[model samples]
Target: MARDADATKVRILAAATDEFAAHGFAGGRVERIAARAQSNVRMIYAYYGGKSGLFDATVAEALRRMAENVPPRPQDLAGWAGDVFDHHQRYPEVLRLSMWAQLERPEAGAEPREIYEDKALAVATVAARPLSPIDVLVFIYAIAQAWQLSPGGLTGLEEDPAGGDGVAARRQSVVVAVERMVHAQP
Candidate 1:
């Protein structure tokens, strides 16, 4: 069978996403990505320039998926928080990849800034009380991600047939926190 360049690139990206998400930029290896992709290192370099480029592309793709999957709703920040929590639950890799990017490569292109600025502007426009748009946006995001970072448990997550409401309870807490923040904005 003949090789298809587009398919090869897709495979490379998917593999890179996994490798980079798990290992981060400094630790992520092009060879692992190539091996996972069932292709060669040369293809990765040719398609993405190098390891840095592949990491950038993988992060960009994760952010793109995140924005598309859980779009910000300035008017309904609480609902948006719930959606964000749900998105994180479904795609933890995306959040991990983002965290890795922020730690390893803090500098970002205008695309992320633009997205934040747009959301902040909308949040400011709809906010009941006078508030810092950036602060509000950041708070909402932090609240939504709280449960993902911690389940309010000392022994990890809890589970019981009697009153085990780990995921649901955590999700509800995230939504309620964002709601309270939105309501209490000043």
Candidate 2:
């Protein structure tokens, strides 16, 4: 009985995650989540307090899942980048919903942003030994932003002929050259 109840809550949470990841806080509907979960609306309120609380829980769960998959560390930078790229590729709606939450309710979304900041600082700390703080931040941010813009893993043929994999390869070469340039300097 207890196990069954727990399973139901987990199913509800999963349904809420998908719903929130698609519609965000302002657009998300409890009835839809309930229907998707095969549960009733009152179950959501009973389990999570209400829609806002569920949104917070859903966002926290989303970030928690991402953090678990990515784990913060300098050694895992490239792997983390790949994980993030794969996640966004598989679930662009999640990213879009996140962007919408940020735009619509900055205050309500503070926890997720704080989580991002903590992850960034952790990455910065690990990377700072070899690169300046600003440089590390820039490097991570650039890789993330560039990956988001390019779906084919950041170095593939694209809409712009001059900006295809060949160009990306060259750009990467230049970035490496610049990193070595800065590192080797007295």
Among these predictions, the greatest TM-score belongs to 1
- In the range 41-104, model 1's lDDT, one tens digit per residue, is 9998898888888888888877787887777787888889889888988888887888887888
Off by over 4 Å in 1: 108-111, 151-164
Per candidate, the number of residue pairs that clash is: 0, 0
Each model's lDDT: 0.79, 0.65
Q: What residue pairs clash in candidate 2, if any at all?
A: none
Best by lDDT: 1
**Global local distance difference test of model 1:** 0.79
**What are the TM-scores, per candidate, against the unseen true structure?**
0.86, 0.67
Off by over 4 Å in 2: 1-3, 127-142, 145-186
Report the lDDT of model 1 for residue 20: 81
